[model samples]
Target: MMFTISVPKPGLVRFSHDRTRCLQKFDRTNSVWSMKMEPKFSHNRKIEELSVELPAQPHPPHLESSRDRALQFNRGQPSDKDLDPDDVFEFGGYVAREAMCDEEYWTAAFLRAETHWEDRNRDRYVESHLRKYTDQEFNEIKKRRNVQFGNKCRCIVAMKKDSKDVKRPVLKSMVGTLDLRTRHLVGGETFPEERVKPSNFGSFRMTRSNRYGYIANLCVSKPARRQGVATNMLHFAIKQAKLDELERVYVHVERKNKTAQDLYKKMGFQMIERATPQLEEKQLYLLCLEI
Candidate 1:
């Protein structure tokens, strides 16, 4: 004899064999369905059983936060009400936003290290006769440096929009970053051209009365270079400076970096001072923009 089983509804099953029928209720405790049947014409008995297991459902995707959506879709200039300390700007498929959490700080530190890895190597060789620290030690130092520097400045990071991949983290999409901080000029005047030291090339003595915005460590990942990521970041940083009520914004660039100089010039930056002949090897130039 052949038995047929059918499920008319959840938690219920029907079985039939040659004019004999039986209804079986699924046992939730054991997650199984069992049916027992007795034939009318024979003293022999037969039982048919089958085990059923339901597959586990997957968890739902994470929902994007309102701030994250704003950062991805907001294109127009931000209004005064939108100018928070952690303002975010989006342009074309990229976003420039203030780095807030530890992860973001770490990512920004990594970017800085990548951009100046060659310099680090050269410095190590020059200072320690090529003695090198292990990767773990170097990373730990970078983390400590990030915390120290982050306490003194605001960090802005540029990244591609990952709306399509909400599962991807921010660090994976980061493309560029820059640092903005308030600086004070000694005696409320710019440093003399000949006296500007490499150690304090664009930096001045700290004073509340002569506060100005300083931009430093503007760099884009190699694959994301020449794609306006740096430009957008600069604009965002300048906007932040304006929001902070800074009267002037300054950036120091190597004199040999014509590309950077040209980019800054296009953004209304004017060279205010050049390094002295004694410091020509450093090739640093101070550029300023009046806000």
Candidate 2:
């Protein structure tokens, strides 16, 4: 059930201003995307080039898209192309590219924290700290995560349809969740010292260099399991990275979570050797894939 796909060498990829833009422009005739970069200081367009053969996993079975809806995403989110209301589509259950509304967005945060706790504390954590977050706390988190302030960070949430004594579907629960981290860019300029680089979790840097997106805060509600929600979210995050012209991708998972590790491996990620650190960081496993 594993397969490989050829993509433009990592060099050809460039992050577009729009997230939904084509990941890499492909020459359908050759099905290849290529890019060559000159020296860092070179004005001439001559440099090294490479064609990358990358491992690709298929989209999830339950993942679906709707083209009829107009383009609507979290405002202030970065994207390469302007979404035309005439031609817009969304994937998974009520996926929000960037949820801007404070209520919904905070709900997503609680969704993540609760999912992480996973009833391990029997609702104690949710009732105490995660139930509500102040604006200052949110801003601080965005800063630490390298997410742009005032810019909505990339995210996707699968919603469950619900109704009270009626058949009409009213969205009830935020079941599945995933968060994405792209390199911080503002006004066509790279943010000061805030690149999404390697070496997360225990300071175990990769032995080699890679420009990739960071994936975090993935969860599926207990009732929503096995319905392809997680797979869809992964596809969204990785696709976002590719469109941003990244060379590779990485995520850290808990060592106790074998199911998640297996899923990432199936998607072509390899286990990375991590640097030694405190026991808390040691409990995490880092997995990565070359786009």
Candidate 3:
């Protein structure tokens, strides 16, 4: 026997066939069925089928750019994106976004500064200043800094008081998370261990001559707060300045924050002998550490 079925709309349909005498036609569109039966109606075949059409969607430009940016960053490639060069300066580690790529491995080490050191430090910066750059720009800065420093530059991040993210850090005092590189001084008969600690920032107070030694926008993410991220950043800066043969390294702390003041003191930093320009009037302590 032979049978045929037709459907006008997209849906599920069931069909049955009897081979006793013969089979016929089933028309779902007209809700009609024709069957020819013979001596026995027990012999039959049944079938069911379903049909559907799906809709299509498009991707947005920003999301695509973000994805591409992440991939490029992961591969240590410079991403094509518009950015404010000054933002790189804020990190105090990257002179330009291009630095991160040349020394991506070292840059990756620097990223460890953000690990959850303390509860407070772990939650803050990631959503604020850290998030400002697409992954591409961030990697570029790391690459650029690495290349500029000849892969010897040490880097660190510190947070501001008014910063939206405030958390504890594992380093306990910002002194522990610093990346101290001796690459700059390697030419002077220095070994790996001795290169990490140079004598600078222990005596030099903030002065016009030393202003260039300081960079702005050092920060630790929320997870690594209170763990000495700030102090370690200071130590890293001092190490770099000393590597450049600078006489001393200086940093200005807001007068209101006793915690930072105490931390600097513990790190062998002294209050300025004389505050010039706006430092005294604004109550910013000019702390000097001799290296």
Candidate 4:
């Protein structure tokens, strides 16, 4: 004899030949299954046959839309869809955002202090021995940063997002920082009064109104160096400067710092003013980028 069974939905169904047993296991959550059957006979005669029909399988979970995949991939963490597109920039698993809250300000201050501590110290031997700053020193830096921020200086921080922390998903830690501020430029002709023979020089005065953006205190964490964080921060600053209606952006770099000079040059910054040797012991070169 032969028996046939049909299932309306996708599930597991079992059958036995000797006792004509029909066992049905239904699970709404599961859409796939595997089956195994073994027949038994008492008298070594003709064995009974049984057949079962199962519904078609559902679509695979991996074959989802790109948006769905992104949502699923960033389930608990903050995503670009949740942020203001104008304020945040995403690149290379990092986000560059404006420093707003107290935690971000403190982090930016700590980054600046930690990276530029050696430059502040005059004595190289003493600097080499110092590993970190005291709490008072950090607080002082933070205070100075607060004053600058109050004075129209904008600070951008490159943050590495941590998806593991559901409480704080956006800014886990700061990798780099850059500050932008408006600066006034005055340009004209000046003649020395100590000229031995002052000829009939044409009295021509050239004065133009020039206001531009200035970038300063750009630094990245030691561990995050050489990973394009600095480049990304500079790009963000340029975009911000354009939004502020500034036509030119300038940066002052140490004369001996070839690495920084090369980076600025690569980003289309030209040396506008070379440091004068007679003026100061520590000289800096001024570079400008016309946005």
* Structural similarity to truth (TM-score) of each candidate: 0.55, 0.51, 0.36, 0.54
Error of 3 at 156 (Å): 3.3
Model 1 weakest 10-residue run by lDDT: 47-56
Local accuracy of candidate 1 as per-residue lDDT tens digits, 32-99: 22334443312221111101110111112122544333332112222224334346788887779875
What lDDT tens digits, residue by residue, belong to model 3 across residues 1-291? 222222122223232242111111222231222334342323221111101111011111132444334432222122223223322223332122212222232233333322322223435564343233334434544453432322223344332222225332211212122333222222121211121223321222222232223333344444444544455556546655654555544456667767767876887878775555455555666665667
- Under the 3 Å rule for N, CA and C atoms, how many clashes does model 4 have? 0
TM-score of 2: 0.51
lDDT of each: 0.53, 0.43, 0.35, 0.51
lDDT of 2 by residue, 60-107 (tens): 112123421222222232232433322222544334243333333444
The regions of model 1 sitting more than 4 angstroms off are: 1-86, 118-151, 191-209, 273-281
Model 2, residue 205: distance off in Å is 18
lDDT, residue 207, model 2: 14
TM-score of model 4 (CA atoms): 0.54
After superposition, candidate 2 runs with Cα above 4 Å error: 1-96, 120-126, 132-152, 160-173, 183-210, 274-281
lDDT of 4 by residue, 1-291 (tens): 121221123325454463222233434331222233233311111111111111111111232444324322112223444456777777886778676443455456555545545345547553343323323433544454331211235678887765544333222356777677654332221211111222322222211124467777677776677778888888889997786566888776666778888889999999864344421343556678988
Ten contiguous residues minimizing lDDT sum, candidate 4: 47-56
lDDT for 79 in candidate 2 is 34
